[model samples]
Target chain A: MIAAPDSPGLVGPVVLSMKMAHRTHGEGATAVHALRGVDLEVRLGELVAVMGPSGSGKSTLLNLAGGLDTPTQGTVTLAGAELSAMDPRARARVRRRSVGYVFQDFNLIPALTAAENVSLPRELDGVGTRPAREEALVAMAEIGIEDLADRFPDELSGGQQQRIAIARALVGPRRMVLADEPTGALDSAAGEDVMRVLRARVDRGAGGLLVTHEPRFAAWADRTVFLRDGMVVDTTGGASGPESLLAGGGRHRGDR
Target chain B: MSIRHGIIALLAEQDMHGYQLKVEFERRTGGTWPVNIGQIYTTVQRLVRDGLVLPAPGERSDDRADVERFTLTDAGRAQATVWWSTPVERGAPARDELAIKLALAVTAPGVDVRDVVQAQRTESMRALHDFTRLKAAQPQTDDLGADLAWSLVLDHLVFDAEAEVRWLDHVEARVARASLHPRPSPRPTDDPAAGGAGGGRARRRSGAPPPGGRRR
Candidate 1:
């Protein structure tokens, strides 16, 4: 159960923000602190990359941001709603309407066509099948892959499949796509192609939190957050985006 | 690297004077390589001396330093073709400052290697972030050639910096692991014929500190 206060509405151009979040797994001697108190924000029209060594809690921060997991301490505000205050059912509905997730693996249903896989979310939201397919096509075209709509996931290349997955991420009323190394299993060229699509889509007024180890891919984001020992150590770039150093974000440059 | 060949390649397209060659070279390399007009002329003069370059037929000047256009000779063209076909040589690895610095830091007494690595990591990541911003600031144009040529090494610098950070992370893990299990100090020699524990330790592994071995 989550406690609800006055719930200051999630404000400004920011789509997601986590304040003083701490995620510890276990208790007492066996406890493992996944995320020490930390703060991060991804504004609309921005792609923020999270980079860290293994065990640095990049995935845990992502899970909290997407409403898939609640932080042990702090609130995750998504789409003007406080996730910490929501019950599980309400949280699920909010996630469906507000966040789209593209995983490391393609995660496409083999039985579904590319269009169907993209339109499936819209259908789940109770839209008519024909209208959903049309919207799916429009989304696919936005990402420059409408030609691959009829083909199943198996029929497409790794890059093309990821673009379709991006189309799915772009389709519903989602505000952000929390892509977890979406370029996994892709070669450099194919990986760049996928980032190009993701960048264009996010440029079209959606937010993105990209988790990647590849600098070439992270170079595409507005800014990159570096984590170490469950704490944010430094952040780079995002000069043109909103000021995200509101809490625990350190812009360390030079010989700091 | 080869200013002579660069000038040849430039002139292969059209006859160009020293200043023009300098400008063209800068443009082709996205300004990453800035060449002085003097260097251009020096290289051009060398080419002309070697019979690989000649003044354009229509261009003439009273003073040798005046604006004289250069054109690649037949031999120059042939050399350019060969250069195009050949691969750039990567010789044996040269000494890198950071590599040397870290090597010394790990072994040097009274030095915290992890701190050094973190400092360098922050600096490297900052540079990478700057490179990324430089890349992102460029509004992609429809001209693919121009876009690709905008800053050929900008993305390369990004990749290099990223690699540096990854390498630093690796170094940190190795250092941390070493600290956790300090190499067992060699037992003091039982026989008086052998020297003290100091000699054995002197020959032991370098930078193997007893991490977390200090007790309350």
Candidate 2:
């Protein structure tokens, strides 16, 4: 007997069902095919990095995966549920319940404190305010910034704000995290910290799709997918080691 | 890698036996490169034969003996000074297998250059991660000279790996561009001067701007 589609042991990809999907903007001669016949799948506990030059449909793919945008053709399935098949209200519920997004700009509300920012999603999902706040604090602590829970976004540094944003994304039971250049605005050291946090979260069982141009950042992912002209050009199968490009073994030859 | 000079530099501090020298060398370099005992003995023997080093008095002559201490002579000290002052020669490029592989991959029939680059990149990244992790584990102390030396060596490895990854990216982009717009074959009878001038005009006609332009 087969396990039910939504059963915990079903163990299919967290995000799937983009077959020959296309996204177009505008109309007639001015139409821009932002994404063309793109197909991808991100499994649970895996972090897939999407790398490409600008306007190569990296963001479009992320948007589609996160259910923020619908595909022109084909389907998108999140957590084994077909997104396009759901009504607007049901789709919105699925997105809110299953998806989390980390943006480059650390899209946090200025008015809400760090805890409030992180807890808002849980509260919106009908969780009690106290429990949401407690969950938010736990998330903040997990990212190593529990002390900043009461501080507003303005009080935090760019790295701190990004961490808070990550905490917000991870606060609830969201299992699919979509990061769009999450480290674009930060310095290298802070960027590394963010990557580490993201990697740890993904390792804890969430699936992720990271859109980045930096190979160093992409190295943090389990696999890197290369996109060009709105299509998958190549994939490194999570084996793109930083030293593979350099000829020579790690050993340095030394004569006595 | 220049163990001869490295031994001389170590002797400049104090006289040491072959075993001690080997230990010192490995210690300073954080054991990234281990020198063979035989090799060390040979290097020391050559140094003594050249009069750059003199065997310390009261040491055994037996080749297998560990009691043979050596010290740098005045000339050897001068040579060490010169070695420190002179810049390393960069005239001869080292044989880089990655470069050769990529060159061949681009021209060889049915060979996927991208796959080669990607495979190498994966190895490079793993090496880089190992190096970085090693560097992080090293204790940072102001008073330890060996720590400083090892850190420098690790930094070299890190930088080299970083440069390799960047070059791979460059190769990938260049190959992609070249495939998109194949370059015209050179005319055998064309004048070098005329071709040079015509090439500029041809670039403009092809809608490819100069380097650092918006087209890129």
Candidate 3:
């Protein structure tokens, strides 16, 4: 029942902020207001979940927070850098160097081997082929996938491919990881394993933002932030455990 | 997630029977995920079919035919590694049935909040009772995990049920303290969202439970 208090002066060390106003697409009456006065921050090294019903702007919020899209009005500041003001090239660089993305589809290159997939990110950054491959092997080993490096995506099972996708995201240097429905493709058992890997990443001083529809998946996060209709409704206090998150959701006031 | 991964994770650590794997899976999950006896046997069959797990010959004979031990293959170990490394997206928790149900109960008139609460209480109690009986019937020689896991599952179920029951009681108390017996009103004819034509439903279905008892 510990709720995060709303205070402007009080800030977490890693404060990810979205301040004021609106975000819209089309002109006039047909405009899509994706965000309306979203003022929220996530602390450093914290794993947070952004949950809401369909079309509630949860994904839009994530896109704005991660610098994937721009807000028509307001600012999104990550680590004190105002992403909204950054140029396209700078924004792409920031996203590539600062943020890691994990998509639900695994998104692995079908033609590439597991090791090659993990190494591609670094190679794109001008890192040497041998060094990148070495680093990829290490990252794969960290996630318990060193032995499957040579196998192609199609050669591997769904779980294996997904694991490679995760390894790929975590391979290069990045401060924060953002995953969109990482476990949606897997069954319950496979999904649980994927969660454990994410949890381990958090334990290693990495911060992550996950957008999921699964309570079981959200239970692993340090905090669960509820959103409704383009506004953050509630946030379970930053507590790293499963029971509180699940039980707290059940006990939600529902009035808000 | 694949039960194959579960089987591999278990057998990779050590040899175990179907029942043993079920106990370990529940233990790892803090008993939040329940696996039935039938599911355990069926998963084992699938694993054997996939060549991920195979029988440990002469591990048990006579009377223990149903207790066949299983071990993972080299390929299974490789599969386990890949599974452990997979990346997952982190997202918000979705559509909470309990929250929605409570919201409806509080806002809707003529809704029997008591019936819902009572039904939940009865179901939870039966589960708790069944868990207790199973625990008592299990052999002393069974692994500690089987005993500990079932206990944790029962604890969560009981505690959750109590929290819900307490909430229901609080609602009733609030209503009684205020002595708020809402005056009955005439039923509306039109569907709230219907634009025109014959409206929504073909039949008017009452929100009432059938006779006899609660159904799962």
**A-chain TM-score per prediction?**
0.87, 0.85, 0.83
- Across residues B68-187, which tens digit of lDDT does each residue of candidate 3 receive? 888877777787888789864335655767657854665467776655644543333333223222322333233566555554554454445435534544444443433365444335
List the DockQ of the predictions in order.
0.21, 0.18, 0.03
Comparing 1 with 3 on TM-score, the higher-scoring candidate is 1
Give the per-residue lDDT digits (tens) of candidate 2, residues B48-124: 99999998777758774687889899999999999899997665556766787897687677788877877777666
Inter-residue clash pairs, candidate 1: none
Residue A197 displacement in candidate 1 (angstroms): 2.3
Q: What is the C-alpha lDDT of each candidate?
A: 0.79, 0.76, 0.66
Q: In model 3, state the lDDT of residue A14.
A: 70
Give the lDDT ranking, best first: 1, 2, 3
* lDDT for model 2: 0.76
TM-score-wise, the better of 1 and 2 is 1
lDDT of 3 by residue, A144-212 (tens): 889999999989877778888777877867656788998989986577568767756654555678898
lDDT of 1 by residue, A1-256 (tens): 1111111122239899899999999999999999998899888878889988788999999999989999899889998889988999999888898888888788899899999999999999899999999989988898888988889889889998888888898796887899999997799768877887787688777889999988678867767888888888877754432122112223321111
Query: Predicted candidate 3: interface RMSD?
Result: 18.2
DockQ versus reference, model 2: 0.18
User: Which runs of model 2 end up more than 4 angstroms from their true locations?
Assistant: A1-17, A26-31, A151-157, A239-256, B4-17, B20-31, B44-64, B67-162, B171-183, B187-210, B213-216
Better of 2 and 3 by lDDT: 2
Candidates in order, TM-scores: namely: 0.81, 0.72, 0.55
